[model samples]
Target: MESTAIGLWGIPLAILAGAIRVSTPFIFVSLGETITERSGRINLGLEGTLVFGAMTAYAIAVVTGSPWLGVAGAMAAGASFGLIHGFICRWPKVNDIAIGIAMMQFGLGLAFFLGKPYIQPAAPHLPSIPFGFWSGLPQIQAALDINVLFLIGAALTFALRWVLANTRIGLTLRVVGDSTDAARAMGIDPHRVRLVATAVGGAFAAVGGAYLSLYYPGAWNEGISSGQGLMAVALVIFARWNPVGCFLAALLFGGAGALGPALQSVGVTSGYYLFYAAPYALTLVIMIATSSPNRPVPGMPGALSLTK
Candidate 1:
């Protein structure tokens, strides 16, 4: 059966599908930010990183004819961006947040300049799992075609939560986040830890970009990201820095983001573009509801400047 067989009732299914598709990038980027923030650093440049990653992945996939290789290239590019940010941030007087904004612009400019040629080239797409085998309806089966990276993102969520709770590396990150002096006393180099964490964060964010280009909406262009990287920063805050919470929050945001497209898909065309505001509105509400001068969110890292 074909996916077009569904009637008006397919709206929900379409939303579900869109949520899964849209949420994958959010899941990965938020997870990366969670890790970076937990280590007492923030990388707002991820918006740029995400865009550049999409370009790198698409270009590589086109040249190599392998989507997986494209993903690898994107990760590498992302890590390099992180490295630059980390190194620049090591100066005593440097402001990490400001640097992040600068990096974001730099990355966007570089990506646009380099990606112009690749925009017209075709690239291979990542594979997916046919999760609709049990469903008799074409819409159901089609909606359930799960991408491989989504599974990995889900796993990373739980795994990150567990690692932060139980592992030695997790302890080091927490100590660094709480206080650099404490980390130094424990013989952990805070700078090295943060650099490594930021790099890993960048790599993860890049994978999110790869998923964007090599999977859903599968192509390379300047606007492929739609501010997903920036939104993921808010997502990390909404999750209270919890990896598992990040995953669930990503789904919520994803669902909200999908509302417009879902409605349009079902022939409900009223205020179509307004639906994209769902995510931004939700983020603002979450931030406002959770924030107060007397009591801040519980899980914020001590060294984070944005919340502090």
Candidate 2:
């Protein structure tokens, strides 16, 4: 390992920077999962949607030479996947988890097959705001270079929280989440609500995927998502279905994810690769700490199958 000007100090700074850079995808995916779970439904198939979205985004960007259009295409593709999942799960005695798994397989297969062609093409990258311009240090500048999607995700966190707490739509969603019977009594359509919520959640997850390809990793490949879609489901639970909590949890996970690379940057490579498992370990620890056989997770929707 070679010493640089930054030396040992780079580890923490790199982790901090990586947190901001990496957390964007987590924020979007967890928020999306939170929204879906809040509506009394779970979409484990988001992994599929995420990969497919990345593929669609990259393909669109390559063809149209417009990153924004690629984003739209990804959203549409993700929503379509959600629509299929929702429609199938709506049938009597059908299992949502099983259907989700199948959908995930289908999506992965589809993305891999189609994404192969676009793997060699370079897509236009999404724009970023140089938040570090005020600082003279190149490290500071790189760390603070915030993406536009990150800003949107941050604003969306507050907006989603407010919408879930203070709006009529939020009330109806809560009613549906609490009980389908209650929703029916109140003239609300729980199935429709869940369908729309799942679609919206998928769209959000797709945006996260778009961010993965069009921004951070900025590439299209079968493994681009790196299980983020699946992890977001657990993240939603960790956040207790709260959007703000999702944001915080995402940053924590992002920091954990960045730990290895940060350590490596500081010449701490002896066991640096182990840090790559930090996020998964954190997830396991959180699950063990928070979960109990005697009681349900706090803030979990009453109608959620896991609660039963």
Candidate 3:
């Protein structure tokens, strides 16, 4: 039942399973933040957006009995929040960071108020593809039970990477991110582009939320996120804002996240709690390594306020 089936081998297997399961949310959120940052704006408020999206997805699934609809609702809610953040930040003298923080608080408060009724309801869970069906072992089957959204997010990472490198829209986004003056010179509306990018980013973040409530944790609660949305910021920096890199970084973080449970499954009770903090420790290490003033991070968008 535990990691006893395959002896010590089950530890890595459990971690692998956990990595695939836990990394889905990170994949989506990091990719979303990558897009937003690539457009020269930052949205720290995605933490709020992620929680609200989870609540919206859970409530919608309970009411509509359709997990997909729940995902859609979450996306709409997240996008709307992104649009609001973009619009408000566009006003003179308004800081993006300040607006993002304000939006985060507002979203959390709103979600808590609206989500109370949904705490007791059970919703339809999202389906997963049994990639391990060929195996007779239950452990193997369970380990290979990959979710549909994980596939979608994985595919989207490569797709997004290609789009950013090859498309006109990508060019415009890159230009806007690199230099506002250059975007204006090319007759592009930087503000409008950023607004749209932020919205798109929010939609991606909400899908991550959908994955959380509708799949993994499979419930609605105030504490569902556990800062995955916020941690995505550091992830983006670690990956240098590349979509493909984001996907891989997410898997690493996910593996780290899975360490504790994997250890517990193997009957190693001692200090397993510390293993849960592996992802946070990884984040801090990445930040320290990348934040040297002498050597600026390459590939960082020049126009991003993070540069300032």
C-alpha lDDT of residue 62 in model 2:
97
- Stretches off by above 4 angstroms in model 3 are none
Candidate 1 — which residues are off by over 4 angstroms?
1-8
The candidate that achieves the highest TM-score relative to the unseen native structure: 3
Whole-structure CA lDDT of model 3: 0.91
Q: How many clashes show up per model?
A: 0, 0, 0
**Model 2: per-residue Cα lDDT over 81-104, one tens digit each:** 988888887889998888889989
Q: Which residue pairs come into collision in candidate 2?
A: none
lDDT for each residue of candidate 3 in 98-159, tens digit (9 for 90 to 100): 78888889988999999999999999999999999999878899999999999999999999
* Candidate 1 residue-wise lDDT at 242: 94
Better of 2 and 3 by lDDT: 3
Better of 1 and 2 by lDDT: 1
Q: What is the lDDT of every predicted structure here?
A: 0.91, 0.89, 0.91
